[model samples]
Target: MSRALFAYPKQAQFGRVLPKNKIYEHTSPSPALKALFVQQIDQIVWQYKLAPETINLPAKPAVPEIQIFDITLKTAELDHDVLRCIDKAIPFPIIFQLSHDNRIQTIATYKRPSEADNNKWVIDGYFADDWQPIETPRQPLPVALDLQGLYEQLLRRLLPLPPREQEALKNHVERLAQWHGKHNEYQKLQAKLNKEKQFNRKVEINAQLRRLKTELEQLS
Candidate 1:
């Protein structure tokens, strides 16, 4: 019989689930519970026809368990609600079998000690095959970032730069941040322009648009 999946807390005790009222407190899972979850995840991998090698299951029950799921090509574009459901159901780190452009990639999402602050959770990397670490650091929880920002930071870290080049890159990043702020302003102006039917008000908006466009061009 298939076992029910449990939503384990990140800092929970090793063996068993904490009481619902005290869920946020740090605790660990028991050895038996860890083994059972690992077995259940393994069974799911088999049922989905996903390669077991893509998953980086711990060699021993002593290690923290991570939930694994094989996302097939057909289901690669899973809707937001479905993805949210999956995320809610799984307690441990999640490994995804992602298919894109006829290529199968193993993407793992595991929590790591936050560099900026220790008492927070951060999804550090998207590991490749054999759990090879990918440097994709993200912001801490509660104030999460969009995937675009995450991938942008990943791409930025792909190569090392010289001292002077690093300085230039830092300036460029600052400029990009400014551009994003201006972009938000531009969007708001466009929205206001769209709703305002009065000719005089439209003329004022058009002037503001021209100035914002000029600033954006300077940034570019």
Candidate 2:
């Protein structure tokens, strides 16, 4: 059941600071803000050309934007890819971290837990569990360009897709859109597509997805 896992647009830049509570409470949210954010996620994917997975799913919208990472561990000698993830790190607290190379080095600077965070888990706070790996996002390409190229990937068609297929896809995409790159995006998405165990479709979809993201980057 291994499948491709690509969330909409990649998560915000690896170490960028997220806005505070007062921000989301704004009276008028930016139009296409979601679209623009998704586009950024897509750009990160294209930039890295990753397949997607559970570990790097930083786009979890619920996760805060800013965080620190620690790269002090080493990938097992048994890892298949040595050059995977640029480093072994993720932003601390809510923000997630992704590495391009598995050889990533884990930094040891960790934040000390505070009594306030322990008492008020309601607000965003750092936790040791935050280090656990998560499922990668599963974002697919729109149908229009899916048939052709990135120039016209029509997201509309995906709306009324054939039966449960569309429903499942929509649900998954919504959840995945929350984070950035995948810890192992490829493995997750491959298990979910066309009932086949593969990944090129993700590549094809990502190619198209990236094209749309370029315009958004300019705005961000």
Candidate 3:
């Protein structure tokens, strides 16, 4: 299988500190949102600019340019709302590299311009990979026909579900979202089954879990 993690090209580097307040100014985040940024985040940097000029990939309407943000964290985990806030502030698609305690993880949500309003973008659910050492080796970016394709490949790397043969990116992401729901259902059923003292209730919960497992497998 091809490696999902990537090492971006040198020509694409755009190292610059992106002030947290700059994002807050654009988005007007609520107090709780500001707390997440102040407590969990240490710094944000614009690490790469994967545009036509930098990467030689033609831009599509939905994916004109991809920004890579490298965020160093105060803790290991970050709220997805923090990422969504940054996405709302910027017009382009973004890929995040989060660093903490000498480890790094890549995360992103499938984002695109809203069909009803070209001025706004729609952000789908978040996906992330397990953390690895900062020194971990990475594969080169995937070969693609355009920036849209590259963005799809980058997001695909973080997705838990692999795309079905010839599946469009939208359909694949939808299936992954379905799998998340089904998997959650299965987990809840399993927990209920384990905690049930009555034999008959355990049997009923087990049956539901089996059905959910099948649905999850199909979605996967």
TM-score leader = 3
The whole-model lDDT of each prediction reads 0.42, 0.28, 0.91
Candidate 2's C-alpha lDDT? 0.28
**Model with the higher TM-score, candidate 2 or 3:** 3
User: How would you encode candidate 3's per-residue C-alpha lDDT over 60-87 as one tens digit per residue?
Assistant: 9999999999999999889999999999
Q: Which residue ranges in model 3 land beyond 4 Å of their true spot?
A: none
Writing each residue's lDDT as its tens digit, candidate 2 over 1-220 gives: 1121223344422433333222224323344543333333221221221112422332222222223222222222212111112111222222123333332211111122245553222222111111223343334632221211221122212221222333443343333332223323433443444464448765775555555455333222
lDDT at residue 115 of model 3 (Cα atoms): 99
Give each model a TM-score.
0.34, 0.17, 0.95
Give the winner by lDDT: 2 or 3: 3
